[model samples]
Target: MIATAREVKDRVIAALNDHDTEVVMQYFARDAVYVGPVGPAEGREQIAWYFEHLLQAFPDLQITPWCKVPACDPAVSAVSEYVMTGTHLGPLLLPGGSMLEATGQRIAVRGAGLCTIENGLIVSDRDYYDQLELFSQLGLCLPEAVA
Candidate 1:
């Protein structure tokens, strides 16, 4: 049986919950791109690197789906928010050529995600989240929020 968009979303969430890079990579297309508040990451290599860094920063990450709607064929668009709270036991690169160690602080960030799947693999994702909140949680530079 072929995998549906919902199935892919579930699997991806499960993979993230497990902190398994291999599993997460399974759902993404080789050329998939991730665009989010943090920044833009293109291709599987960069995507994998980003996830790896995230896993290192928030090893115990869990994603809960707020809602999901299937889009044009083979595409499942989802609007969901996830909370990631973990210790910052690793080095985090900040703006202005600065790095900060994890303060073991807990952070919860709400996000909006749109996942596009093709041939059962995620082709692209557009993520809407707050980078300011993330930075503040990490004790990094805090930029003014958009009014």
Candidate 2:
């Protein structure tokens, strides 16, 4: 039996909550593209690396999906709103090529993700979240701009 997009998304979410990168990778196509706040990760290897880094940064990370939009085509798409809670216990690579060392701060950031699946595997995933919210939670503030 073919797996629907919702099924694949559920499995992926379960794997993520378990902090099992291997299981998560299983649901992504070899050439899957995962686009997040930082950037796009093309291919399974890069995607796996992205997940690994996230788990490392937040070893106790937990994702709670509060809402899921019914996919018009269950076989091809899935979307959901979730809150990710975790402590910054490891280094985080910032967008401007900076590394943020662990501040031991706990954060609960609300976000959403959309995935496109094909043949039981995710081909593309786009994640949206407020980077400023996350940074502020970690005690980071942007420097003032000079006129």
Candidate 3:
């Protein structure tokens, strides 16, 4: 049976909720591509590795979807925008051979994701989020002045 977009969307959210690397990996196609704020990554192994590292670096990370749209086919694809909130309570490797100290600071970021499912697995995934928000939370920048 073809996978409905709703199923795909639900599974994606469920995976995040589980915060289990194996569970999240189960939803991806073997050759799926993932694009996030950091950059593009391909294949299940790479995506799993990235997620695992992220989970280690931010143990309290959670993502919540704000808007969801199922494709016309109700299968194969969908787009979802989300808000991610987490605390920095572990080492975050940065440039210059330095790791940022965990400030226990909370961060909320806006992000958008596009996913394509084929053969009941997500064959492609793409996401975009605010880098500035991360920088600001890390004490690298002053909060932007409101208009």
In order, candidate lDDTs are 0.74, 0.93, 0.80
Write one digit per residue (lDDT tens) for candidate 3, span 1-147.
Answer: 766756876777777767877888888889999988777779998998778866766888888998888866557888888988888887776535477778888888898888888888988888888878886886776557999
TM for candidate 3 is 0.85
lDDT of 2 at 45: 99
What TM-score against the true fold does each predicted structure earn? 0.82, 0.97, 0.85
Best candidate, TM-score: 2
Per-residue lDDT of 1-147 in model 2, one digit per residue for the tens? 879887888899899999999999999999999999999999999999999999999999988989988578878998989999999999999998889999999999999999999888999999888899999999999999999
Candidate 1 segments exceeding 4 Å error: 69-75, 95-97, 141-147
List the pairs of residues colliding in candidate 3: none
Clashes of 2: 0
Worst 10 residues of 3 by lDDT: 92-101
The whole-model C-alpha lDDT of candidate 2 against the native structure comes to 0.93
lDDT, model 3, position 97: 44
Q: Write the per-residue lDDT of candidate 1 for residues 20-108, one digit (tens) a residue.
A: 88989889999999886667899889988888887776666666666555555534554455655566667665546466676777777
Q: Which stretches of candidate 3 lie over 4 Å from their true place?
A: 93-99, 142-147
Candidate 2 local Cα displacement, residue 13, angstroms: 1.1
